[model samples]
Target: MQTIVIAGGGVAGLELATRLGRDLGRRNKARIVLVDSAPTHFWKPLLHSVAAGTIDPSHYHVDLARQAIDNHFEFLCGEVVDIDRAGRTLKIRARLPHALGHESVLRYDRLVLSFGSVTNFFGVPGAETHCLSLDGVEQAEAFRRRFLRLCAATSGGAPRVNIVIVGAGPTGVELAADLRHTVDTLVRYRLNSLESPCQVRITIIERGPRLLPTLAPALSEAAARKLRELGIEIRTNTAVSAVTAEHVTTADGEVFPAAIAVWAAGVQGPAINTRLGIALNRNKQVLVDEQLRAVDDPFIHAMGDCSAMQVSDSTAMVPPSAQAARQQAIFLHRLLAGIERAAIPVFRYRDQGTLVSLGEYGAVGMLRQVIGDRYLNVQGAMAKAAYRVGYERYVMANLGPVRMFAQMLVRWARSRWLMPVKWH
Candidate 1:
């Protein structure tokens, strides 16, 4: 029997592992193995909510070991240090906890590379050390702690708390709105005894001309208007030169100091890709062909944020997104399902629109592909409902519809009955 090893536990890797584990491993035709640095999985899109205390990660973290057992696969907790393509073996440096239980090298018949991406500080001075980011649970929880401490310190005498978010992309925009909502909710609950009201100000600085620049101009305008209505500041065409514990200096010699800084500027593939000797794009992402195989190596397959793929017979390229990852996972799974890789069909990417949640202020989305080149924009309640369902659908993929719906109801009840935002 052949062996398949997937390295990553993000959306693409996890889904593929679960399906292949059951489909291939159950029949005893092949063995499926999932290797990840962490023992659990969390949706990258919700990191902002976690940072803002809008949601608890407990509801989203999926245990890889438990899934592996139930799905008939093996789970390894370690980091892939080196890959000997010719030898068909990988050097996995186990984490401290896994060192006692796992081996250092794993053999594989086929390899799938989906390690995912990381935060790109853009070589900005002090940006990495000074600013907070929402890259993982630890980072998000760190931001939340800083946020709580800032609130506690400034509840009365600090006048106001200023938070500077660099980047007007979805993460930055959504974080701003979530923070605004968190402050209001905290005030309403009267948790801080430092006066009747505490103000928390959010300022999003964008080098681009507007927020959500990749989206339609109309949607961008709507998002900007909604954010402004919430008293969140928007600074367009502003480039940050440096960051310090006290301030962020721009190219124009202007400095915004005395603010909590968050660097959501952009993302690039993990630096380890360069060491892999694989063909990579400018962003350090592995460049894959239509079949989702690395351009330079046929045996290596890549997906998720760390990979960029060009579709066959079309000028379109698949962007790194949750939807694209899901499509890629399904496509890859089908190719490996009782079919030879050489006879696998070409993978085609479908644009499945985009939905952005604006905390409690509302939401905005664009329906594309299904509507052709032109898109129909939806906002407010309708967009919010769509955004809510988008997550539910991802949950359905992992937890199944029945359990996902039940979890949704539990979350809804918790939000309504317990508290809208968590303080700790």
Candidate 2:
């Protein structure tokens, strides 16, 4: 039996691993091994909520070992250090608690790379060291703790608490809103003895001309308007020159005193990707062909935020998004299962649209029209409902529907009856 080793237990890698495990491993055709530095998997999209204290990660993360046992695959908790292309082998270093585990090398018949992205500080001085980021579960939890601490410190003396979020992309925007909601909830629950609920000031700074610049202008305007209505500040076309523990200085010499500074600027492929010796794009993402195979090597394939593929004959590449990653996983499943062998269909990303949740403030979405290139903008109750179930629906469709629903029910019950905020 052939062995398939997938590095990175991210959204794409995990989904593809499970699918291939069921189809090939169960039949004794292939041995599927999923390797990741982290022992558990948490959806990247929900990191913002986690940082804002609006959601708890314990209820959402999937244990890789448990999943591997249930799905008929092997899970290895380690970091891929080196790959010998000619030898078809990889060296992995186990990531233990504070102590480093010995490295182990494993041979594979084929390889798939999907080690997702990391926070790109863009070489900003002091940004990398001082600013908090929502890069992973640990980082998000750290931010949540800092947030609660800041609230506790400022609740009595300070008239206001200022939080500066650099970048107006989806993460920054959604995080600002979620943080605002969390603060209000804290105040309402008497967790913070603030003079007023609006004492916490949140500001998002974006180098781009507007928030959600990749989306339609109308949607951007709607998001901006909604954020302003919620007392959140939006500074567009502003570039940050430096970040410090006390303040964030912009290119224009303006300084914002911040109790908490978050760098939600952008993302790039993990730096270890260079070890693969494959052609990579400017963002350090592996450049792959239409079949999702590395352009320089056929035996290695990449997907998710770690891989970049050109769209058709255009200069544009597929966007790094959860939707795109999920689509590519599904396409790979079909391609690998021999369902499209006669004429291996090229992987094409269907733009289902983008949804931004604002917690209780409301939500905004841009739904792509199935017929044309235009998108329909939606907001209010309909958009909020869609945003709420968007992730649930995706998980249900991909994972077992009944199991996902039961987990969601438990989460809802816990939030409603016990506690909604994740202080611990």
Candidate 3:
């Protein structure tokens, strides 16, 4: 039997493991094992919300071990340290210190790497070492802790809770809106008129000409307008040369004072990809061909944010988004059933438009017509409704429709009877 090992149980990886497990492992046709550094999985898009304390991540986390049992696969918790391509082996380290102190060397007949990406600091001074990032749950929780402390510090007086976000992409924009929502929620619950109006000021700095650079121009304009109406500041065409403890200095010599600095400017594949003896782009993404196999080795496949699969007919590379990752997972599930390197099919990513949530205030997104090339530009109620539906669809994909409905009911009950996790 071919032993198929998938690393990094992110969105694409988890879904792939489940599908492959049900198809192959259940039938006793193959051995399927999933490896991840984390014991649980939370959708990456919600990291900003988690950081803002609008939602608790633990409530949404899908336990990998539970998933493995239900899906008929095996789960190993580890950080894959090295790939011995000649030996067809993986060197992994225990992801948690509490686990047994041992290094594992596992061999795989087929290997898939979906390890995802990390925050890219662009080598800007202090960006990597100093700024907080929303790349993972721990980091998001850390930011939330600091934010709550800032609110606590302003118990009886006005405090300027200044935040400098060094990117104006979806993560940055979403974070700004959610942070504002968090402060507003705190004001309503903990801070009364006897106190100040949260004293929170957020500034988004982007080197690009506009926010959401890859999005439709009209949609970007709409999002920017909405943000401004909510009293959030935007600085376009502004580049950060360096970050300091108290301020982020612009390339043009201006400085923005910040109580907390966040780095959401860009992303690149994890550093381990560079040492894998495969061809990696400057961004550290494994350069894959049409079939999603590493250019150097057919046994090695890379997916999601870690794989730079070039567009079949265009110069543009596949953008790192949950939509793309989901599409890839579905495509690969059908293609990898044979578990062979021959007669592989190329992956063609579908464009499903974009959705950028503006916290509770509202949302903005452009939905594409499945029948045509046009887009349905959406905002306000329509966009907000669509946003919720998008998440529901994801839940349905991961947990099935019946479980999704039950989960939705639980969330409604919690919101009705219990205060938000921030209060706890």
- Tens digit of per-residue lDDT, candidate 1, span 250-343: 9999888645899998888987789888899888999998778899888889989899877666765677788899999998998877563566
Q: Backbone collision count in every prediction?
A: 0, 0, 0
lDDT of 2 by residue, 243-273 (tens): 9988999999999998889998888999889
TM-score of 2: 0.96
Root-mean-square deviation (CA) per prediction: 2.2, 1.7, 2.0
Q: What ranges in model 1 sit over 4 Å off?
A: 96-103, 193-198, 311-317, 338-344, 369-373
TM-score, each model?
A: 0.94, 0.96, 0.96
Tell me the tens digit of each residue's lDDT in model 3 across 256-325: 9888999999999998998898999989999888778899999998899999988888889899999898
Identify the runs in model 2 with alpha carbons over 4 angstroms from their true place.
96-100, 342-344
